[model samples]
Target: MAEVHSRSSHRELRVQAGASDNVTANELFDIEEQRNRLSRMFCFDGMGGALLIEPSFPGCGMIDAGKGDLIYSNALYEIKAGDRLFRSVDVRQLITYSALNYVSKRFQIDSLGLFNPRVGVSATIPVDDLCAEISGKQSSDLFFDIVAAISSGDISR
Candidate 1:
């Protein structure tokens, strides 16, 4: 999934993904080893829910059109293969995607989630709860503020 990382930051990943040796290739095999388990961890009820991989939502202001890791059922789960637990960047990524979806009205995103296969851990929170916990604002108000801020040229990048 394309999180908010710069191109240069993925140079090593590009090399790792394309590495010629067997050991390195096996070392970078996240999909082969982690996909099903991580999806399950994200509560991706293999049969019941709609599973969308790399979903793109309508952009707002400078956000542009962006694709998230995936959305299973109604929850948007940001999949991370990092060595540790959830990070701030992970939460920001979900919030940014949610804000984008907030304006897009693409689908009913009732919950937000973070999953790390590397740590075998996952966390999910309802949309309003996440917004309230982060900013003490309802999701609608928080999303409106973000759109207004970006549209008003408040952010440089």
Candidate 2:
């Protein structure tokens, strides 16, 4: 956390980039706290797996233009920074990216993860386990459905 004072010059270098104005000391402190939490996050630095930051999404070898935040070992992780915790869309977004990776065959994705440093929470689920919860459909089956839809032009990438 940073010290909040009456001085006009705030050293909020890490909180926001490119511009220093319009940011309060409390926000900088909060972001620092969140950053500290992220640093303590589970072994993303080689112990877990090979870490790739903002990797390109080679979708279906045709659908170009999408980038993943991070890939650790076999899991694709999406980092979110917000005050809310209970968002299914965040999970759904990961699933979509996972589907893209599956169809593209660029990387071996075996699991999916969501990490929110602001709330100091992290979770990951195996792809197989997640697919098991989806009524009688494996990850392959579900992901293939997306590919099929994309192939048939029923959906936009």
Top candidate when judged by lDDT against the true structure: 1
Give the Å error, residue 20, model 1. 6.2
What is candidate 1's lDDT per residue for 1-157, written digit by digit as tens?
4333222222221334554555565566664457556545533443456566688877888888888887766889888888888889889888888888888798789999988776678898999999999999999999998888878886889
- Model 2 regions lying over 4 Å from their true place: 1-21, 42-48, 60-64
Residues 95-147, model 2: lDDT tens digits: 77877888668778888889988887888899878777863689889888866
Q: Model 2 scores what on Cα lDDT?
A: 0.70
Cα lDDT, model 1, residue 123: 90
Q: Clash totals for all models, in order?
A: 0, 0
Candidate 1, superposed: residue stretches over 4 Å from native:
1-21, 24-32, 42-47
The superposed Cα distance between candidate 2 and the true structure at residue 124, in angstroms, equals 0.6
lDDT of each: 0.75, 0.70
Give the worst 10-residue stretch by lDDT in candidate 2. Answer: 1-10
For residue 119, what is the lDDT in candidate 1? 65
